[model samples]
Target: MLVEPERTAYDLRFRLLGFPIRIHPLFWLGAALLGAFTLNMGFQYLLIWMAVVLVSLLVHELGHAVMFRWFGTNAAIVLYVFGGLAIPQAFVAGRWRRILISLAGPLAGFLLCAGVYVSNRQFHWASNPEGFLTGGREVGFFYLALLWVNLYWGILNLLPVFPLDGGQVSRELCGLVWGPRGTRIALQISLAVAVALVAYSLLCVLTANGPALAVVPWWLPRGTIFTAILFGLLAYTSYQLLQQLRWTDSSWDDRVPWER
Candidate 1:
């Protein structure tokens, strides 16, 4: 799941908290496109939605960057279509360290979600609220919407699928349990999870109820049949990556650091 970026269109943006953040033009365009589809609103509201996308995704990636740096490594962030990536240049040793690095991103998201939830509640959304859905008209709606995104998306990213934070943690756990076979087992688990996800999404639709792609965000494929296609692709990619990395001990083997 971790690889060096192609360095295509790497435009250096502003810095914050000592991390030199660079953004790809595709990132903004993607966010704007997602905002346009996800939000049923006008130009001003679309702009606000884009702002939410930018800030929330930035916070999630920052969580990973901060934790990587805290572990004495160099890290940078790239915001992209689906989400952001925190590229770390240092090797994390030990299972605990690896798990910690993987967990940092989702932890950051949940933390942001909690903060936003508190703010939403403070704005009376939890009580006699005011916002897009309520009788009130203010930024409260934005707060609540972002709270939903962060909460749901954070938890979704934690699902035990390869390339996800939870998948990384699951690999560490499997490694501890199965030793050398852990990597394969982890990949197997990922494939299973991906299949289940697609099936669940389908079931939801067939039931004549809420979407089968419940976990799929509005920005993703417009919550259409492509949701199944997306999961299928993830399943295939996981299988392929497992085939590629199966030969190499990608820090998921049972070997000790020096033994590697």
Candidate 2:
């Protein structure tokens, strides 16, 4: 039925750096569906966004897979709507190794963003005084798209939220400090953060306010329904993770985050 297509789509595979890469069709479907919102930006920009997100996400996941391989095991990648996952055959031997692997993904994203930003600077978009007000010139639309998505998304991905790189990193850190109770501590921290984010998003949307701090960037996402939905999704995941606390150690590795 409906689930079959999704399964089949994600099952479509290829190889990257010798690791299997399975791309879920929803990735494309989600990007294509964004066309409605980008109608004013034109179909060309929509196409560019889709392509940029795909490539940037691939790079991010490759960072994880590459690091995983360093631990002497093969890994597989799954790219879907939100982003990608690099699942390894086994966890690395040490907590520091696991932390390094977790950090590698965001590091890759940062590097890719910097690379794109530098490559696009020659186009002279920044020289246009009116660039910021106009979303930059057409010549730099894709560049801006790539830069913003990679940079902002990469930074956001590093936030200490469960299943996120930063969250996983924090989890390992807590494990080092707290012993067997680290998992529960991590879950609690993630839930608190998720609740705060959800509350912030709701407050921004409902009260038309943002962080009171003067230094907070005005360009940071706020009061958007889309971001609200994202925070809502994160809240759901936080709830799920909280419920997963009872899981035994052996069951943890066998299931993916989405499954939990």
Candidate 3:
């Protein structure tokens, strides 16, 4: 008889090259939809770009995973639509280690981007139209686009806002000084920064005259539907963080030696 596998709170688990991995079913569903949409674009060369993106995301998450493992923390990698997540158990243990893990993702992405850039510059692919005019430029364009996407994604993830790598780094540094309470304050500040960014994104969408809102949809006007939903989600996440902070305060205060 085949033995049934153990289940965890997250979801189904699988082994990849002896490394345990668990993925929420929703993640695979989203990946399927994304692949379908990419296929519909009819850019056959985009498959190469997609492969590059997948590799970059994996490398990025690996940075976090390696650091977590080095610190003896249980960590799992989950790939999602935009990118991936590295959920490390006991992540709050050491401040500097936490900061290192947080920065590792973006560092890996940026390094990949640099390698692509150097290759492109050495090959002079973009400058040589003759190579494309004689044959086809699809591959060249795909690689260039991949480089840009990875570079932009790395920089974007570095933005100092909640749920971003930079924000996590900031939180970790603050935690060193303020203890668990400092993390709560940092989270609130990060959320505030996110709110400001969302507002600016909406403002840009509204000012632009278009059939639909460029960012979301025209039917969903700025501050009308999507914006409201965006803010609502942010608010909900902020509330959850606040609740977690409260629990941490009540429970950890007695056990942990805080700075203050």
Expressed as tens digits, the lDDT of each residue in 87-114 for candidate 1 is 8887878899889888888788789888
How much is 219 displaced in model 2, in angstroms? 4.6
Query: Which is superior by TM-score, 1 or 3?
Result: 1
**Ordered list by lDDT, greatest first:** 1, 2, 3
Candidate lDDT (C-alpha), each = 0.75, 0.74, 0.65
Task: Name the weakest run of 10 consecutive residues (lDDT summed) in model 1.
Answer: 129-138
lDDT by residue (tens digit), candidate 3, 68-116? 8878876677765455787776645767877888888888888888887
> In candidate 2, what are the lDDT values of residues 1-260, reduced to their tens digit?
00112457245688978988888888787666644466787778778878878888888889989999888878888887777788888767899989989888888888988877665455554434444623355546677667777787777778777777878888898899998779778877877887777776777767667355335478876645666677567767877766766655556656677954
TM-score of each: 0.80, 0.81, 0.68
Q: Distance from true position, residue 190, model 2, in Å?
A: 0.5
Scored against the true structure, residue 140 in model 2 reaches a CA lDDT of: 69
